[model samples]
Target: MTKPQGFVSKDRNLHVCKAEAAASASPADEQPLLGEPEQPKFLGIELVTLKKIIPLGLMFFCILFNYIILRDTKAVLSVTAQGSSAEIIPFSKTWVYLPMAIGFMLLYRKLANFLSKKALFYTVIVPFIAFFGAFGFVLYPLSNYIHPQEFADKLLNVLGPRFLGPCAILRIWSICLFYIMDELWGSVVIFVLFWGFATQITTVDDAKKFYLLFGLGANIALIFSGRTVKYFSMMRKILGRGVDGWAISLKAMMSIVVVMGLAICGLYWWVNTSVPLPTRSKKKEKLKMGIRRGA
Candidate 1:
């Protein structure tokens, strides 16, 4: 007979049997508990951090570059209009600025890949020399012979309305050539080297912070450029007039550009050589691992 319904089976040893079952279940419970939790990893660096800094740099570069362009244009235009009845066209012969636009885009991509610091240094210096050297040796001599009155009359007569005739084309082409040789090449070189240095030294995050700082430096440059133009004007007052005065202004602008280039280059070289590469992040390692696994 069943001894009362809730009574334990003493003879069957039910308590010991239940204890053994609990012990067996304990190891199964411990398996999930013993597994490790995932750890957080740092993100890898990227080049986009330079975005803010670049615009600032560009602003300054644009200011200085534009001032030089404007100053040169005014001087050249004046010389071309000298003793002429034709209104000195503000940008009649300044179409050369277009070539500079093209050259800047092209050289920017080229200079970005340069890994060698020395190569970059030379890349910057050589362009400056070639540019100003040609201006000094070739263009300066030609300027002495330029009769603005005659040149303007001939150009306006030939250009007529189409603005694509022989003289117009030549004038524009000449302007483009000058811009490329004198300004665009050097500007791209400087920008590439500066950003390259920035990218190399800082992690993506730090770059975001310092890029703005660099931009502030660039803004200062723009402001400085305006002041420099005034100084050039003052110098022109003291130095006399005509082709020689313009030449001095051009030379002064080039000298400043050259100095700035050299200074930035020196700074870049120092930063490039001195700063240690950023430490790799776990996320980068994981990504590498994933790639390997996928492969």
Candidate 2:
């Protein structure tokens, strides 16, 4: 009799998962499917009867960290954009940006096929995180000066600038790029992939009973993110009084994003390494047979 997936031995250890044991034997393997498990400890407080519950906490933490930064990034961008409202183009009132979205989706399809999940995750996400870091110290400070009135005038001449102002054109252009990259952090990272990751390692039953606890992480992130945005706002106001307050705040926010990115990465590493998903049935049997033969 084969044990069901996510099987645990007699000790009823919350962390034990046969699939993880088999999969963890190798370093570079895909995460294993979830199996039936013993009741796991909830919040490390009360011992719950639900099976395969503990490991999913790792997934929850990852989601929490992702939102803590991504949501904050959205707020930061909004604040920055508001501060520089004079520069923003009024194209948002129109549907002119639809073509660009269509173009991006077309490109995204090809890249999804070409890149492995891990590689694709890094390729898309790492750069965005790095951008936040670089933006903090670099692009943001020079932003007001970067797109001069001269360049805006040249763009107006060549691009058929109708009713929009030159500064507005430059601001809109910068914002478009920022919006695409920032949106991807949520779309590709959280909704598309991360949710799938949670589903991959959890059974329907376990997910149903305990998912609410997992969802609580989002609220925690929301609260923490609000505070983070507030702190940055205050710091920018007090410290950046002599200089550009908005620029200073943008930098501070981006730096925080980088730090959160690091924490997320470390949590991801721990999730994969320590609480790995279950491996295939055959692999487990093979390993067991080999061990018995060796003994």
Candidate 3:
């Protein structure tokens, strides 16, 4: 019983194509494992190196703006709840967000069956942008009519720290909704969507180089957000107090938030198209070159 002309010893690669037979003969066993070397450095920080980290850096920039808005929007809502003066714990913030986390996780799990990580990312981005746009342009303006300040003040005596209650505002429920939204965005957007998209684009080797810097980049956004708030306040001053200045400021900030969301989507598109992360089919080819099964 003779073997066929181009048959191989390996069970898996036995049926491999003629051109690829030599390559797939021993996919994972052939490469010599080497110790990590001192990465090439120019200024203590590997400014000039043998790898690409710029795409990760761009992803981090998008995360910076996204997370900053998540932080400040929550801060603004918390402040607004006490008439822009103080904050009240409307039930434990922790308790409020826990069920939200569970629900989001369930939604994401279901969506994962039908959508790629990229699609899930946009699904998250679009709704939030639409909500903020409506808030800035329409709902916020009608807030006084929808949930009047006079009504809020009447409740002040029952729930008071001062002249107003701990949770007294023209749109009391809207403030709480935004507060909860901010929490959900931090959980879903930062931890799930951004990282899920990042994982698709990154390899273990790439993670070693970029993940720390990614964290540092996001934290720095905290410093910039104060300056951003100041700039918007200036915009309000220029627009004039009696002429719906806060609305002008909110609209301007919301416009920038939409742009940041676009930047994240664009970066995801670029990483997927231009750099092209490996798929399962490509992974077989790479394994032929040296990568181990679990490595």
Q: Report the lDDT of model 2 for residue 149.
A: 53
Cα misplacement distance, residue 73 of candidate 3 (Å): 3.7
lDDT for each residue of candidate 2 in 204-285, tens digit (9 for 90 to 100) = 7556767788767667667777787777767765763468776667766677777777665565555665554655244432
Residue pairs whose backbone atoms clash in candidate 3: none
Q: List the residue pairs that clash in candidate 2.
A: 5-35, 5-36, 6-35, 19-278
Error of 3 at 26 (Å): 20
Off by over 4 Å in 2: 1-104, 154-167, 279-295
Count backbone overlaps in model 2: 4
Which clashing pairs does model 1 show? 80-148, 96-175, 96-176
**TM per prediction:** 0.52, 0.63, 0.66
lDDT tens readout by residue for model 3, 1-295: 9876555466446555664866666733554448756545655444332123565566567666756765676676567543544534345264556667677666666666577667777887778767766776776677666666666666775667563433353336566556676677676767777776667666676677668887677666666766787887777777644697776777787777777777777876776666645454344322221122211
lDDT of each: 0.51, 0.57, 0.63
lDDT string, candidate 1, 1-295, tens digits = 7686556557357888888887888532653345675333235223343443344355346434544544554445434533421222334335554555555555544553543456755665566555654564566447536424356557767668554333433443333345445444435444544455456556676755556665566566557677877788678778744547756776676666555555545555554454445665435322221322321
lDDT of 2 at 68: 63
Model 2 / residue 35 / CA error / Å? 18
